[model samples]
Target: MGRSPCCDKVGLKKGPWTPEEDQKLLAYIEEHGHGSWRALPAKAGLERCGKSCRLRWTNYLRPDIKRGKFSMQEEQTIIQLHALLGNRWSAIATHLPKRTDNEIKNYWNTHLKKRLDKMGIDPVTHKPKNDAILSNEGHSKSASNLSHMAQWESARLEAEARLVRESKLRTSHSSSPSLQHSLIGTSASSSSSSAPVLPSSTRYLDHAWNNGSSTSTVATRMSDLESPTSTLSENNVPPIMTSVIEFVGSSERGMVKEEGEREWNKGFQESTTHLGEYKDGMENSMPFTSSLHELTVTMATTWGSSTTSAHAHGHVSEDGFTNLLLNSNSDHRSLSSEGGGDSNNNCHGNSSDGGNGTGNELYEDNKIYWNNILNLMNCSSPSDSPMF
Candidate 1:
């Protein structure tokens, strides 16, 4: 069956409403709420259709509706909300209290849309025109890696959130001794009757324990409070390890001795012989900066030997950057012991006292380039960022 029109078109008066008609509609609605717009026209004693009457009341005649030019704040609010919600004007209207969806739509079309277009923003996407153009470029390998990391972080957060909710639920369930005991009994019986099931937080820990030979990759470093776990896979996705690792690392590890602790002990204990040498090597390892300094010097020396350069001896050489970093440490010690003034800084050569402007510029550009690479490398590890 076809849906009926809001009101019959034959007898209805439409378009601009007269002042007399507006008064009649407003008076009726004020006395009794505008219930069922289909029936409102007859009850309000107006020739206008119910849809027209409803629009007039909601858009203009409503006492709460703010009629005036949109303020700077309101315009900004509309633009932001439009970006999020798109053409759903009714949804946007909810956020901008006292404004009608119709009014906002008109304002955006007549004013804001043209302004944003002039400023090189895509009104629909609310992003720069240049960004939109660049976005059309296909995803790179680095983009794929970033997406994988993002998915992992999202899953970790979601699992942690679920664990919190369950913890709260458990706390509430434990408040009544009888209920707690009953629930425990039921869970025990069910587990004993069938295969034992684990909580989502503990499931990954169990998987890690059982799968002893699974290799662990360090995506993130361990905190002071917790030791990092070996990664376990189910369908090749890393399992939720955050809460389980925290629980195991905390004082609560002692409580799970019968179940989790035994499996955890047995799993890692079997690999101790193979890991012993690695552990010893770690204990004897140099600090990261010292290790990096040595690596950089070795790499630069090799690179300089392999490649040809036209630069003069005093200018920044291929190996000069490595030497610069190496000298910085020695200079720090020298500055501490002797006066800071007399040391001949080989890093800058004569560039320190305003000689070799071109060399200084080249050095600065190289410095910035290397610093950007180092920053990108640092960002690859989740442990470095607080957001992760």
Candidate 2:
């Protein structure tokens, strides 16, 4: 016989949870302690499906459920973990102390995903959408840079492992006097005598062990270099290793710079397209720069100070930033340039509409632009390329 439905189909409440229904479910679970969700509704005298009861309790009414907004730290953790683990919401919830997988999934769908979309980032891949543009400009640069970094980290890890193995071997050999004597050639004639002759293998092993130790030290220094909190104390990281990390950081910065430039250009093109089709009344009334700048400043200030701001401004800024980039100046190039170059200049100058009817069209096109960018960036290598 097949398994039955979780609860009887007749006369059960379905949609939103009512107070009386919540009381019945909560009272039943509180007293009886909820053994099996599939069997709970019938036993509890609740007119709801067991699955509904379970979802209601788990997602909404659970005593430990954190009902408010997620903090900035939580948002960052979610983003980073999502980048690493994809849509395994249940798995992601494990790292989060008081959150449910369902809640996380909903938040990502309603909030985080939209935010990433607006920011020209691929929600799935967590990479800049302009990767193709960067690549087309003959920048195999970031890939090579990341590859070299991975090599250095790999080498360091390997060297540390080798050192540990050699240390174990030496400790074992030294612990057994018979083996030590045989290996070192310590004779009875040298009883009270000086140093024993070390075997060639033993000498080589000692040298290997020392080299491994040195390599581990270099690796630690590299790690410190990569960390933002690291400071130059009286005892700084070794100069040679610092140089290596600096080189890697420089390459990574170049890649970021290239990606930023492409994003700014894409934003500008999108804005221009909108400006062209803008209606006379709308264009005249459009306080483009002031409105977007106020939005951006408000969002930045809000998010910079509060945990709940993550949920509030998360999606808003992505859309706002893109729009701001668009309606701003034509000369707003080189987003990652030092000393607040064209970006600041554009931000200050491009506050008024250029009397074009493109604003509404630009807003409509924003969604499509982000979707296309996301699709392109999320493509898994060349064989699955969307454009091709």
lDDT of 2 by residue, 291-374 (tens): 222223222222233213323322122232223323321222122111222223322232222223444443454334433322
The count of residue-pair clashes in candidate 1 stands at 0
What lDDT is obtained when candidate 1 is compared to the true structure?
0.41
Model 1, 173-231: lDDT tens digits are 54553322222211111222333333444344333333321213211211211312313
Cα error, residue 118 of model 2, in Å, equals 1.9
Position 153, candidate 1: lDDT? 34
Estimate candidate 2's alpha-carbon lDDT, on a 0 to 1 scale. 0.41
Best by TM-score: 1
Q: Residue 346 deviation, candidate 2, in Å? A: 47
Model 1: what TM-score?
0.38
Give per-model TM-scores.
0.38, 0.36
